[model samples]
Target chain A: MKNFYKIVAVVGLTMTLVPSLLFYFDVIEIGQMKLYMAVGTVLWFSGAIPWLGQKRTQN
Target chain B: MADKSSILKRLDSLYEFDREPVTRNKLQGIGNFLGMYAGEHVAGTEFVIGMLFVAHGVSVRDMFIGGLIGNILAIGSWAFLTAPIAVKVRLSLYWQLKKICGSMLVFIYNIVNALMFCFLAGAMVAVAATAVGIPFGIEMPALSDMLPNSVGWVVTVLGVGTVITAMAILGFDALARFAKVAAPWMFLIFVTAAIAVLPKLGVTPGAGNFWEVARESIWTGVAREGQSQFSFWHVVFFTWLANAAMHLGMSDLTILRYAKKWQYGFSSAVGMFLGHYVAWIASGILYAAANSDAPGVVAYEAIGIAGAICVVIAGWTTANPTLYRAGMALQVASGWSRWKVTLLAGAITTTAAMFPALVMKLLDFVALYGLVLIPMGAVILADFYFIPKLGLQSFYAEKKKIDFNLAAGATWFIMLALALFLNLYFKIELFFLPAPIWILSLGAYLLFSKMYQKNLKLNLT
Candidate 1:
């Protein structure tokens, strides 16, 4: 279950990063890029929050 | 006097193991230090500072190389100056300071430190206000704006400040978790935003003309109207001394005390490179592309709604901790409940946030506050190392039960007076004052301690 969440987090991160690069290179429209970024943001929180504090204190 | 003593005793009891060395069992590994520094340095200030560098006309070559050298110096300061002392003592800065400066002086320092923290959090609130005002089509403050520009601006600042203050008063644990989760993602947005905006500034990714475009349109080496011209030296010194309070002023002694080894100070490099260096450059690119001093507008234009939301979260998360710290500082002096003090701090901060100049003049403000706190750091260094070597007692105030160490107090005031004299009469820029004044302060403390300690010995005899 933890691995599944970790994979989901990584995929979320990739979604956030790849679309920006794609937008930069003109491979995708910025509108699409923004949508992916927003989604990626949600996905990242979903995957990361369960593990954020239980693993270690970041601040 | 009795009341004050009781307050000091209460303050001492508020923290666990605050009055003595941290035990070995509680020491943290390097990974904790790395993550903490990385999460912290990429904050709301990056949005203002990077853009300000462009506004001040730093050339591309100067920006990169100067920032590199400056950040290296900062890392060295943390490692050599702050971390070693923290490891040797294993006590927080305030507790350590109380031993050297005595309770009265530390009380004064607490008040001054709290005011600086409040103003800093106010600046972050202003940054967040800029984004919150966006949906309302509220006019962004121009670079030259020092006052609140519109009713919408005032309302936005008040609204944002209230939320931030409430969060601070409530507790920081939840927000801290949010900050940690957001840090890596926030850093990536900075990178991607710059990349996304490159074409708007006439930089084609594959073209060999990238540098040319960057030079002409981006860094341009031309100051905007009413801004001072900056160069390699400005960038180097400003970046190096940007967090002088934390490193040179010994404030990080509180945090670094938990490190298992002094070498963990090198973990600051992650923050310096990622946030101070790259994030600054990226935000500068966004500013140059958007041609706006409003962090939200530029960020929004670069990456759309995510960019704007990032500005708001960046400001709020950073401000929450700052206001909390301010409350803690005040709680020592005021002897009030944490929530009441936090509310008072929030009021002061929110009032300051109503003005736009705090964020607009953030570079100067950062330098000024750091300069103000650094003399006490010099006193600490001198008392810890040179006092014993000079045959004077270390922690003299504690040994004698003095409530105010005249030598330490004198050192702090004289240093501030000298700094003011140099700035007002000699026209030295504020950014260039900390280094020279720090040296002068160290020498002054040593000389004064020699005199003061001898007199006290004579009196006792």
Candidate 2:
């Protein structure tokens, strides 16, 4: 489960970073880059649900 | 079948601890602050603001210097004026106002506050529509337009508004979560899109004449055909006072109250620098790079479909929280369920969004919105500080169990009246109104409070 969380976090984070990185470095044009990144962003947050679901209360 | 009551019941089950102070255990780290501010600030409005700067004939040097200075003051205000109060009080601005102004005065204040927030969010929704309508080839609203441009525009606004409103109805945590994730990607898109367009403005990668390109092509010191010129001070005030209501008006008492420490107020710097400063500059470059009036089309020209989509989401991130705030304010004032009031608030916001005039006249609307709300913030400040000092009482209404605090109500009305008189008769511009109104609110509050308390011989501490 712990490893699953880490993998999900890493993959989700990379999805977000890669498109921006590709665009930033002039490797990719702006076309569809925002769409790609937006999907990645949603996945990034959604990936956390499993961890948050079982997380204990702060108190 | 699931009905309205069932829906309201499920929504109520979320049960955000609204009226109570947030416990230490529930305190959020700096990530939430950083993400939320960056998301909210680095938003869809930057597209319009940056384009307007070009239209208003702002020079590069003046815009850069003034924007930087103005943003710094805004950060200071969030950190110094708003954050400290928020952490100490640990209450939403609405709830805290009820304590000081009592129920009646607070009710009036909440209505004004909610409408201003809804209108402001509506402008963002309209901004999103500019992007959504790009594919359908709906004509974008011009800078001077005051009415809905087409049925296409109306349909796009409703579609966009429904999605954002649904997100807002989920409550504050949902809003924050959405922003936290969306902010990073949205911000990066803003920067990359600007860079992608530089080549079009004759500033190719090897040209190495970026400054010259920026000066001549981007922030050209010549206004569009019919627009008036903006100066350094204009840039500074507009940039600083842009969120003057959120910061100086103490609306962020609702946001910052969630912070673990007052120093987290400094976190506003992320949003100011990234969103207002860099994003504005980038969008300006895009506006100059492309001839289109629509942010979607301009971004589409530079970066592609994704760039246009960024404009849509940028509007979403900003509008979501703003509508959330409006919903909360109306819910408290009307004693209705949060989700239902949010629906009503969203309806009003969507209606406002149908008219492109809301987006076209954004500069004036923002200035006026902040102006109307500034006096109440001043009154809040006075009550927070002066009541305890002048041998009067803090939370006088709460302590005395009164339904109406005439002093607080009187201060709001009289100060607003003075402001209207100044603007209408004296012909003061919105840019010049906040400072004088602040002074006026302070003085009027002190005078009224002294007179009200003494004449009534109200319960003194």
Candidate 3:
């Protein structure tokens, strides 16, 4: 459970910070910036997989 | 302890004997928290907030910086203040408060909290109705619209409200599941819609001129005619305090109490930055394109069907949890079944949605609602932390078997009055009052409790 939280925190934080950096460094186009953000969001949600799966197992 | 046993027995009965008790599990709890926050944040309100920043004339630097800083503070408040207490108590705010301030006082506070939530959910229903109404050739309300102008609007609002209410009534699991499903997709729509329209607004890709056009054309920090202008401070403060009632006000104690650690609160950044920041910027760009001199519709009109649909969904995503919370508030106050009260609250929200006023005045309404509820949070914080350190008993009402705890009651009222006085007498902005009100309520509770305890000579032990 603790490990799952750490994964969520790391993934969530990285997803949030990475886009801001990419946009700042001019490494991505504005369109691609948004696309990268969307992908990052997917990863953040993916991190929640462990958490959501836990509920099913407990039930 | 006689008082404590009776309340505990009643709470046990309310949950039914067979149900499992809430436990701190990091994964499941974080999943629920992430979904609820992300779904709620990304949906409906994004459209309104995006348009609002544009209306306020927020500079590009201010919008980016202000949004980032403000959301960080909001996330921090949730992580540090709300989550720790939630995990420690492992109880809903309503049940916990009954042990602290007594049933009578909590009853009154719960009613007010529920109504504020209903109205907020109504605003989201209004947003969704606008999108549904588009295909029906239903007239959409303006930025300043207040009243229900037509039957089509009323019917659409009721329809949307019904769906939102049904989802809310299914309880926490459903809410979490729905949020998770919606958060990612809704986020995509926001991004796609914004990107699709950037070129229409005369912004080009991969050119120095594109960034220049973004600054001048897309995020020009200029308000259209008839809209009230917002400054950097207003944008920053509004974003910071938008969920003031939930995070800073400790409302999420109900949700976060299941977390294994306070850090689960940091999961809110997903909702805040992704939904609030990125989505907000996207919607603002869409709104900018929609603005034209001819102006048959507002900036949202230019984005056509797609923009309007996003606005409606955004409203729903945010409003569903708000309405669900309101339903819980009503259940606490009325002692009615949670499902039933939630349904009733849904009806009220739907009715409120028929009138465009709530959505139109969302900025002001959010500030006012936060102001009203924040004092209770301050009282809770003081009673929880300060009373023990000051050598006063916490949960004095439960400890003493009192029906009404005057110390907590007085703090609630006095803090509200002081906040109102600041807004009216000192002519202070509404956004600025929560901090002082929080401090004042804390001090008032401590002083009032000491005096009350002295007079009653209550046996805290």
The most accurate candidate by TM-score is: 1
Which portions of model 3 show Cα errors greater than 4 Å?
A1-59, B1-32, B162-176, B291-309, B331-340, B458-461
The per-residue C-alpha lDDT of model 1 at residue B164 equals 93
Q: What would the per-residue lDDT of candidate 3 be over residues A1-59, giving only the tens digit for each residue? A: 75775576356545544553454455655556445555555555566544543343112
Predicted candidate 3 versus true structure: per-residue lDDT over B110-185, tens digit per residue: 6788899899888888877777766687767776567887787788888889988887786556555545554565
- lDDT against the true structure, per candidate, is 0.89, 0.78, 0.72
Error of 1 at B326 (Å): 0.5
lDDT string for model 2 (B213-258, tens) is 8889888888887777788888888888898888888989988988
TM-score for each prediction? 0.97, 0.86, 0.79
**lDDT, candidate 2, A3-37, per-residue tens:** 68656755765665566556645677665556665
In the order shown, what is each candidate's alpha-carbon RMSD? 1.6, 4.9, 7.0
Query: Which of 2 and 3 is ahead in TM-score?
Result: 2
| B290: Cα error in model 3, Å | 1.5
Candidate 1 lDDT over B125-236, as tens digits, reads: 9999988888999988989999998888889999999999898878677877788888988888899889888878887768877689778977878988999999899999
Q: Model 1 clash pairs?
A: none
- Name the candidate, 1 or 3, with the larger TM-score value: 1
